[model samples]
Target: MGLFPISVTVVEPGRARTGFRKTAAMRLGSDVGPHGGTPIGGLRAYLANPAAEPPG
Candidate 1:
């Protein structure tokens, strides 16, 4: 019999242009201004459909 061990980790960037980040920044009274994240649905959408594109 044999066994194997594996380790995995996941990370999400902060201080970026993401909406979540923007909201936090706004709460802190920072000038988030009018910027956007990855666009559309963000990372989740991109990861789900890496080939997605905005409609024309």
Candidate 2:
């Protein structure tokens, strides 16, 4: 039997003075409730566990 290890690296750019907030605001609109947008934390967690089985 053999074992293999994997390493991952992520490079997120530093926050700059941009119109990102305005863009998100326009896209999200006034809907400030649950399920209004994608779950970023969950997505990152899933990405972290690359060996996990795919969701059914």
Candidate 3:
């Protein structure tokens, strides 16, 4: 008998100019400025840029 491997993959939604992004950005505000080397910073950058790609 042979066993077959199962493969699973997860995907994140693409970026869109939804108001939610703006609200989230406002909530983050200066309290969490883009650190330039962290996940939050990536999020800030993503939120700031309308064409920026989402983090993987």
Best by TM-score: 3
lDDT by residue (1-56, candidate 3, tens digit) is 33977777999977554578779888878446447679898787777776663443
Which numbered prediction scores highest in lDDT against the true structure? 3
Instruction: After the best TM-score superposition of candidate 3, give how far the Cα of residue 12 lies from its true spot, in angstroms.
Output: 11
Write model 1 residue lDDT over 32-53, tens digit each, in one string: 2343253533534343442443
lDDT of 2 by residue, 1-56 (tens): 33867677999975454454445545655444565356844443344443543433
Q: In model 2, how many backbone clashes occur?
A: 0
Q: Provide backbone clash counts, one per model.
A: 0, 0, 0
Go through the candidates in order and give each one's C-alpha lDDT.
Answer: 0.42, 0.50, 0.71
Q: Is candidate 1 or candidate 2 better by lDDT?
A: 2
Give residue 38's lDDT in candidate 2 (0 to 100): 60
Total residue pair clashes for candidate 3: 0
Q: Which segments of candidate 3 are over 4 A away from where they belong?
A: 1-17, 30-34, 53-56
Ranking by lDDT: 3, 2, 1
